[model samples]
Target: MRQAPSERGIDPHLHRDITELIEGLEFEHQEQERATAEVSWYKEHTLFFSLV
Candidate 1:
């Protein structure tokens, strides 16, 4: 019987899968950067105030 997609076997779908993985990682990185920038902006604009 033939093995089903062994680790040593060549897959025709590998290229598409790798491309998708890379794109997903890049998208996540962009989102992280945007979140970090927003947090930094909020921190910079914050001021300490005391009320009596």
Candidate 2:
């Protein structure tokens, strides 16, 4: 929290946008994580199999 834009000597005008930036970054990170997990699951499974 101490390293936030408002505390790091950033312009006061830009400080107000920090929350929005954090939210956007969080969303993007979650999307990327979800995609990675899906890929891992796919790699652990087989695309074809025999019933015999």
Candidate 3:
């Protein structure tokens, strides 16, 4: 069965799902940035890259 669009031109459930998805993506982005920063710090101060 087909569904009708909400007043905002999208289904309300779809809007909700999209919002959650964006939030999840943002959270993951923040996590990756944090991890990268940590690794970058180690790379700058450690001998892990001296041999290369």
Candidate 4:
């Protein structure tokens, strides 16, 4: 009859603990992306190096 929030990309019960966890994960993911981008740029900027 009705689906839970988790099934729809949401979680109510987890709202208490999961909210904080997800927030941290979001931040971490963004940081990782930034780091990856920086590394990519360094590799590309190098004159004689290929890291990717």
The prediction achieving the highest lDDT against the true structure is 1
Candidate 4 all-Cα RMSD: 9.3
The candidate, 1 or 3, that scores higher on lDDT is 1
Task: Report the number of backbone clashes for model 1.
Answer: 0
Superior candidate under TM-score, 3 versus 4: 3
Candidate 4 TM-score over all chains jointly? 0.45
- As for candidate 4, its clashing pairs are 5-10
Give TM per candidate.
Answer: 0.51, 0.45, 0.58, 0.45
The residue-level lDDT of candidate 2 at 47 comes to 46
How does each model score on lDDT? 0.66, 0.63, 0.65, 0.64
Comparing 2 with 3 on TM-score, the higher-scoring candidate is 3
Query: Mind giving the per-residue lDDT tens digits that candidate 4 earns over 1-52?
Result: 7888667865567676888789877976666667668765644234432253
Q: Candidate 1, after superposition: displacement of residue 20 in Å?
A: 0.3
The weakest ten consecutive residues by lDDT in model 4 span 43-52
| Cα displacement (Å) at residue 13, model 2 | 4.9
> Where's the lowest-lDDT run of ten residues in candidate 2?
43-52
**TM-score of predicted structure 1:** 0.51
Candidates 1 and 4 compared: the better one by lDDT is: 1
Q: Roughly what TM-score does model 2 have, to 2 decimal places?
A: 0.45
1-52 in candidate 3: lDDT tens per residue? 6555443497779889999999977976666666668765543334322131
**Preferred candidate (lDDT higher): 2 or 3:** 3
Instruction: Give candidate 2 misplaced runs (Cα > 4 Å).
Output: 1-13, 39-52
